[model samples]
Target: MGYSPSIYKFVEGSDTPVPLDMDVVRAVLSPYDIGDPNLTVMDDGRLQCWVRAADGSEAEIFVDEVGILVERPHSGPGVFAIVAELASRLGAAVLDPSSGVFFCSREAHACLPVDMRKDVIVIEMTGEGVRAALIG
Candidate 1:
C-alpha cells in the first residue's frame, strides 16, 4: 500500500488552533472536484472525500472544530496550490505528522519536489499562522 500520508492544517499565531467552518472549506474547495457530489457535511460532521482531479488518487480534505485534515496518496502540485492558497488566506500551516515539517508558504510547498514531499511543514504563527521549522 502507498504511504497515504495524512496531514492536518491549522490556522496559527493564536493560543488555540482556530476552528474551521466546514461551510467555508466547502466554499473554498469548490474547484477541486473532490468526490463529494453533494458537498454535504457527512453525519460524522466532517467532509469525506476522494480527489478526482489528481489522477483518481484517493484523497480527502475535511475540517473539524480545530482544523483541516488532508489524506492523500502523495503530494500533487495542483492540489498543493489549492491547499496553499487556503493556507495563505487563513495564515495556516500544513503539519505533517510523519515528518516534522511545516510548509510555511505556498512557495515553500511549490518548491519542494513532488517525489520528495512526504508531507507539509510547519510555520510560525503570530496573530494567525505560519510554520517554517522542522521538528523531531
Candidate 2:
C-alpha cells in the first residue's frame, strides 16, 4: 500500500488542542521560501508542487489545513527524507522519527491556543486527486 500522510500537533509538553490555521502555518513555512518554480499557490491558497531528491526522483507535496502531506509511491526511502527536509525547512521539529510528525517551531506555535492543538488530521486524497488545503 502507498503511504498515507497524517497530520499531528507538534506542540511539546502541552495537551491543549489547537485547530490548524493557514496564516500561522504560512508564517512557519515562510522560511522555506518555496519559489515559484518549486512551489505554486493555488487559487484556494493550498500549495501544490514536487520536491526533487538528490537521486532525481520527485515526491508530491501538498500543504493545507490538514497539514503538509507528501506522497512518492515509487520513490522509496527518499520520500521520507523529503518530508524531513521539508519539516526542517519550515523550522518545525520532528516529533516522531518514524512517522515524521513535525511541530511548528516554538515561536510559531505561540500563534495558536493550546486547545486548538488537538487531533492529528489525516487528509485523504480523493479519487479525483484534486482536493487540497493549506495551513496558512
Candidate 3:
C-alpha cells in the first residue's frame, strides 16, 4: 500500500506534493502490496504490472500508440476510480488523491498550469485519511 509519511505533508489543510519516483510510488501503494498492483505498459504492446496487490477493484491500463501517453486503471470501483477518470481526461496519472487531499506527480503538476496548481489546497495526510471538505 502506498503509505509513506515523508511523501506527504500537512499544512494549513490539504496534501502537498513531494518529489517521488515511480518505484517509491509503487512501494507505498496499498493496493499493489495486496496483489492488485496497478498495470504499466511495455514497448511490445504487451502488459506488465509494476507492483501487485489485492483488491476487488478491477480495471485495465491503456496507452496511446506512441508509448509516451498512458491511460491506466481505465476504470475501477473506489476512490481511485474518481482519480483515474480525472487523470484520463487530463492525460495524467493519479499520483495521490485521498478525500480532500490532491497530490500529483511533478509531471502532472507541470501538465496542469501554475494557476491550476495554485488553486489546489494542501492538507496533511492523517491516519484516518484526508478530509475532502477542506478543498471546498
lDDT score, residue 136, model 1? Answer: 17
Per-residue lDDT of candidate 2, residues 10-86 (tens digit):
44445433345555545433443335553578898777665554445455666765467555423334444454444
List the candidate 2 regions with Cα displacement exceeding 4 Å: 12-38, 88-136
The order of the candidates by lDDT, greatest first, is 1, 2, 3
Q: In model 3, state the lDDT of residue 25.
A: 33
Predicted structure 1, TM vs. truth = 0.58
lDDT of 3 by residue, 46-69 (tens): 433432214344323333331212
Candidate 3 local lDDT, residue 22 = 44
Model 3: worst 10 consecutive residues (lDDT sum)? 2-11
Computed on alpha carbons, the lDDT of every model, listed in order, comes to: 0.49, 0.44, 0.33
TM-score of 2: 0.45
Residue 74 lDDT (model 1): 38
- Number of clashing residue pairs in every model? 15, 17, 26
Please give the lDDT score for candidate 1.
0.49
> Highest lDDT among the candidates is held by which one?
1
